[model samples]
Target: MPTGTISKRSVDAANPESKDWLLWDDDLPGFGLKVTPAGGKVYVFQYRLARPGQAERTPARRYTIGKHGKLTPDQARKRAKDLAALVAQGIDPRQQEIDAIAAEDEAARVAAEQARLEGELAFENVAATWLDHYENEKGRRPSSVRQAKLVVNNHLKPRLQGKPMPHISRSDLQPVIDAIPAKQRGMRRSVFAYASILFGWAHKRGDIPDNPLASMVKPQAPKARDRVLDDAELVFVWQASAKLTDPFGPFFRLLILTGQRRSEVAAINWAELDRSTATWTIPADRAKNDVAHIVPLSKPVIAELDQLALAEQIKAEEEKPDGKRWPKSGFALTTTGRTPISGITKAKNALDAAISEAREKQPLPAWRIHDLRRTLATGFQRMGVRFEVTEAVLNHVSGAKSGVAGIYQRHDWHDEKRAALESWAAHIEAIVSKKQKDSKVVPIRAAL
Candidate 1:
């Protein structure tokens, strides 16, 4: 090492005498310029650690300041003095650098840990979040939103509940696909689609860096079911419903009698029905089309609703206290009256059992609760109900009323709707009355 005031000219002129060497700055001790064998010059600061009680200087530690040309001699001297000040204060610049690096590493570790915990977001958690967004945040159809929840609860969460987002791979979901029955291919496809959409939502929100199911090929398209119940099945549905208990029985009858969706009929609140006018008004939020719907309550529909209301009133009376009674739930088809009747699968199973028990030789064909809605729509078309009127009764926004026609044709067909439902109800009554008389003479046959 050579000691001197390191100048730009001197530094540029300095040569490595057959090897790399350091030229120390005399003005600022321990600060020097190194001349490499390749003729590159860089500034460096060198110092020894301080001792507590011992007089001897500890081992020296070196710190690189900057390059020669990048930081001029003056700049390097100023930086070197600042570092020398640290040394004089009994601080090790090298230890500070090491501590700074360690601190940075620790911070990075903590960040990584936080990210890891956040990444632990499971399929069930994301499903709930997605439902919240669907119901509360976005203007989505309630039916579709409910379907998403059903898909998550019945299909998704049961399979992929606790698994972390990133750790869930394609293979992780294979069992879910395989477990679905072959007959429910449509449902299997729907579950996959719902999961795919949910995971995609999580990915877009940066909850997960990537969607595991993004590259997954969707399940094969299911065979479309257009099986509508005929006149005989309608009779069987009407008659067999009597065997089912309260709420479920009336619920089934209303599905056929009103020609409305299962959810629509089941979700009817007492307040929604006007006993004077015999009309049920479904709010825009509850309607599948996102529009308010008015359903004319025919004699049969009104009778069932009155019966349910009476039962609720009796229940309220029974649960009454000293000169005070709690009001019953506003729901039309609720066992608890507080919440609408759910666990439809169990209800359907009970209906199936009753149907089987009613007709000994033959049972009703495998049909969904939605099939009753389809049956009503088919029956309406068969009974000479106008297309627009039937569409109004069903609350459907398709066909001639789908596009611009829907915007222009604002006529709610209030009178026509009432007539249509009345006609459908009378038609159903004829079928039921005919079946009652012919029950003993004829044997129950499967739908043709």
Candidate 2:
């Protein structure tokens, strides 16, 4: 061993021999530089655990400070002094370094696990997975899927977008249910149901440790809607619908004339309409009851559809200069011929504004597009149409057709359905024309 104050000059003058040699620092005991025959130079610190008032000496332990070029002699000395202080306090510096490395590794592992949980259990990510399973795996109807997505995006996602699934408690979601307006009781109930289903699914799949809303009381189901538009309101809505642009204008009128669901009517393809048969056939896949429905095209219904077709044709002709040609067949009512008209809510808002403007003194009550179907059903009842005929016309599987009767009575009621719908159309014409009340059923073709 060669002893000296470890300085830059002494370190530079030191040479490697046939064997490894150490130059111990004169200023700091146990701090030295080791030069290997392989031309490697390293700074090292040797220390023994302090045993206060003991006759025996603990075994010496050595700790590698760092490579010489990587750390100057002064920098290595500062670290060696730190180790010496720990050794004087009866701490083994080498064991302390080993323990520190172990703690750092444990901390890194825990952080990585936390990151993985965040990525996998985030509310948005889990909700997306659940929705995909709900729609594709569970085979839910398109309308039901759309409704679920609407509630999640519009109500839930805004509140819990990036939150971890397990960290979410009932407190985080209760406000979401409570925030829905009283007027939208159905929506409130739907939000609660959707949240419960999502959390329940996560818990079942082990994506979440526990369901946050497991103990929360579900919102009460909304009362069945019996809202039927009166004759005056019906007339007001019909007249206001005229103020809207293409697609929506005819879309609203067709919804009223045919008494079909909004989605069913909006998604009507030109192929679904048969002019020769004078019927719009809703395929089983599109129909809510999973049974095909034939809606008789009364003269008024045909008239509205014809006007839509002609308007689409005229617009296509106008677009000919722009290299656009009319599609041979597509959606019956669509702004673009490629797809059915969407943004129905936006269109309805515009229609309501028109209605409000038309009747400035008396505001029409809040009503949904679904209310139109109910209104038409009520109208059929008042027209003396048979219950079975009305059920067939509306394609409802309940009432006269449900259970034993539905199993037994397989009547298509084609002619009776036509007569009922025509009568309903005639009644609508009467209301719109202000010609007569619904008491006398006028022939729709004569009225047209």
Candidate 3:
């Protein structure tokens, strides 16, 4: 007899002292609720497979039934009946009960938090709020971001991203900074520096407590790429452009004429072009500084697009079943009318192949395709193009202005830029035959 449960006889006796006579007054030796000597009522369960006179029971388990306050008497009895059925089924009723409780706990834990969908929301509510506000919002997985993340996730985040974002300081970043190659380290530093800023941004919004980047040191930039492409290398790129068919041919030519980034040219959409005006409008979203840019399309740029338009119209007429008659590189890059090339990968393949083509012919100084822009600038400088005028042509923000004046002078610079680019385009056209030469299969050495 225990102190809690009152027997029916005790109720009939109308005496509280009779509670000691209750059947469930003590911890239940088998299953269901019980009462303790101190009068605390609790659910209890005990299970065995054999009677003492029978064969010894296999190992049995015990588990809680439920607190008396939590489970009504009738409810506890029903649970006890269920346990008895399990015991009849040759199951250790107590072990099943314990297993059930463990399973419930595990389910609750899983439901409490689900795995995060990383690509969702672009930036917020998903990616650990790790990058930028807008990028997380609008950007997709591109080469640049992919490359940058690989470094941070591999080298930095395992060490720092989970720490209090504000607690990341210069000392924490110093190890990665010092280990990077002397020439390639600036970008690595920029990644963490940007990360620190992002974490700080989160902190300011009360998402975090401190900015580790506040005291973080920026890694010094490695050697600058100052090498200018020589005239022979320049001519070789153009000549290679001539030998290549459709899109690659025209793309390299456009790159040489406009001196814009390859990605800028590759992703060009028809909406961005004003053919009549011989100009292209680059939306702020696409530009590095997020400023709108207007490029005055040179004759070569327009002429090249004109060829694409013709091919596109003709291809539309000749219509194939696959899909839209995509240009060589869709948007800005086009090969014929039917197929559109996409992504940095495809566009880069074109450039790399073209570079290999050029190398075979002339074997000029080693250089990357991006050097074309600097080469054009340097060529223009040599051609007596004014530095500021060339910079304007390049749509670069001038260093002289400060603050709101910069906002006021967003520096479209189209008019002067047009003239400057035309001058350089004329210089390039003289050497590379975008018009004079056509794609003829000639041996690289023989052509050279």
Residues 266-385, candidate 3, lDDT per residue (tens digit)?
A: 667777887767778878767655556788988877777877766666766764433223243346564433333444345445555676765764345566667878887887666666
In order of appearance, the predictions have TM-scores of 0.69, 0.70, 0.59
Query: How far off is residue 77 in model 2, in Å?
Result: 23
Residue pairs with backbone overlap in model 3: 2-25, 122-136, 123-136, 166-210, 326-338, 328-334, 328-335, 329-333, 329-334
lDDT of 2: 0.85
Q: Which regions in candidate 1 have their CA more than 4 angstroms from the true location?
A: 1-107, 110-128, 131-135, 138-150, 153-163, 167-175, 210-214, 317-329, 435-448
Which has the better TM-score: candidate 1, or candidate 2? 2
C-alpha lDDT of all candidate models, in order:
0.78, 0.85, 0.61
Best-matching candidate per lDDT: 2
How many clashing residue pairs, candidate 1? 0
lDDT of 2 by residue, 146-174 (tens): 88898889999999988888888989999
lDDT of 3: 0.61
lDDT, candidate 1, 1-448, per-residue tens: 6788888887878887778899988887799998888888899998986588878898777899998778998899899999999998988887888999999999999898666655547666677878888778555765677778888888778877777776677898777877899788888888888788888888898877888777887788887777798877788878878877788889898888888887778788866777777788998877877778999988888777767766766765654333222123378787774788888889788878777777785678788888888877777666566788778888889997899999999888778777767766767787778843323322111110
C-alpha lDDT of candidate 1 relative to the true structure: 0.78
